[model samples]
Target: MTKIHTLSCDIETHSSTDLAKSGVYRYCEAEDFEVLLFGYSVDGREAQVVDLANGEQMPRETLDALNDVRVEKWAFNAAFERICLSRFLGLSTGTYLDPASWRCTMVWSEYLGLPLSLMGVGAVLGLEKQKLSEGKDLIRYFCTPCNPTIANGG
Candidate 1:
């Protein structure tokens, strides 16, 4: 087996709450939607987060790493991250990273019939301080369109 250099990444995306209502094709094509936040760890250390919302971009090396076949990318639900990154970077997912090179932690969790959420999985494994406690709220706020009143600051 070939040794793999792993890069763990998590991305926050903005989309509608009603994914079904918009459909996958439309949802993926939604306007003003892009990666809001990116959290990543190389070899499981030196964790870093970049708020793309603040006009931050991943380091060139990180982008290069994604294009390298020798490096494996890990994400909880890699398809979502991969798609989001592709959209954000204006590159097709097929051109960025091979699906085979990405690992989904959620898959492992599902294999064990354990909880698939990051927090739930962390809790099950006794991991201290899972990524974000208020991830749902964050997702709702950033990913979905704000309520009309809230958007209007009412």
Candidate 2:
């Protein structure tokens, strides 16, 4: 019997998805959506980042594992990753990665009465590493429609 491999992934994306307005499915379904960066770790290995924005492709084996239900896939809010990646993989909007193979750290956080953000969980759990403080500013700058003001250099 083959031992199961656990793969954890995190992604940064751009979409018209007003996540607060539309739910995850609709958010992930935005026509302009595209994954920019992909961070991942397999087994017990140190994580690696793939600059999808720079046109890097995931390794064939990693792609195979993502499509393989036998291996476990995990993320902070895994449903978003699963649905978004389905689109990235050209599986169409309604199609999805199997729920049976996906795990959500956010769900687990809610279940444990912990905060449901990477930063929150890290602080609460006293993690040595945490989400970047500048990430939100960066997201606002690039992930949304920006004002064509002089400051923005439109």
Candidate 3:
């Protein structure tokens, strides 16, 4: 029997002090931007996280797994991951795996005309209750620039 390939991933980002002004783009280009997190799983199990804030890096084994053609790296927005990995590893991402090899959950969701958000899909599938009741508020807080204390600079 053929063994299933593992999925590898990494997430790069910059956190914004203000979500409103920053918007989603802020995560892509924050001044202090860096690869904030890394995730990987084998056949969708044993998911792991590496927090770059703590100076964590992928183990040599994980890096070896990435070079295995049998493994398929997964990501939400793969381009970000690819670019971030390229910069972090000091090697062109092309050397490890073709960009086409990575599977994007976000793209799959959109193909079904479902909400593009990971949280939205989870809710629709009844897999889990929405984690954030005030998603918009939280996104605004963490992602977007903060609205003026008073509207219109009251």
Candidate 4:
């Protein structure tokens, strides 16, 4: 059997722009846009996270896989990952990574009449090690815009 190279990724980002209102492209254009964390697994193995917001560099292997057409990139919402990574890699504004090389699990779930979210899908499938229940709350805390106040460590 031929082995296929796949990199599954999820990223947490912080942006002043409202992603729900503006969409991924506009969200990427925000001045305060930043990729806080990049989590990925190679060939379905255990995942690793790169803490970019804290100044951690992505590993060279992950970098190469992202750019390599031979390596199929998979994510729940693949377009977001591709576009965000394009900006993070300093690609020209409005230009994004090739969508042809990416796959979206959300699309698959929708096609199968399953829930679109990772957590929802896990619950539906009764998968072991389902997504964390507190993930959404944490995402709201770290990935969304917040008032800059002394009490909140602004």
Q: How does model 1 score by TM-score?
A: 0.82
The residue-by-residue lDDT of candidate 1 on 67-88, one tens digit each, is 6767889998887777667667
Error of 3 at 143 (Å): 8.2
- Give the TM-score of each candidate: 0.82, 0.90, 0.64, 0.91
Lowest-scoring 10 consecutive residues by lDDT in candidate 4? Answer: 1-10
Q: Where in model 4 is the C-alpha error above 4 Å?
A: 1-4, 148-154
Ranking by TM-score: 4, 2, 1, 3
Question: lDDT of candidate 1?
Answer: 0.76
Quote the lDDT for 68 in model 1: 73
| Most accurate candidate by TM-score | 4
Using lDDT as the measure, name the better of candidate 2 and candidate 4.
4
Instruction: Between candidates 2 and 3, name the one with more favorable TM-score.
Output: 2
- Find the number of clashing residue pairs for candidate 3: 9
On residues 2-78, what C-alpha lDDT tens digit does candidate 3 reach at each position?
A: 35576756453445434345443334344544565677776767668888758987777676655565567788767
Instruction: List the pairs of residues colliding in candidate 3.
Output: 18-144, 18-145, 19-143, 19-144, 19-145, 20-144, 20-145, 21-145, 22-145
Error of 4 at 14 (Å): 0.5
User: Which wins on TM-score, candidate 1 or candidate 4?
Assistant: 4
Candidate 4: deviation at residue 60, Å? 1.2
* Top of the candidates by lDDT: 4
lDDT by candidate, in order shown = 0.76, 0.86, 0.62, 0.90
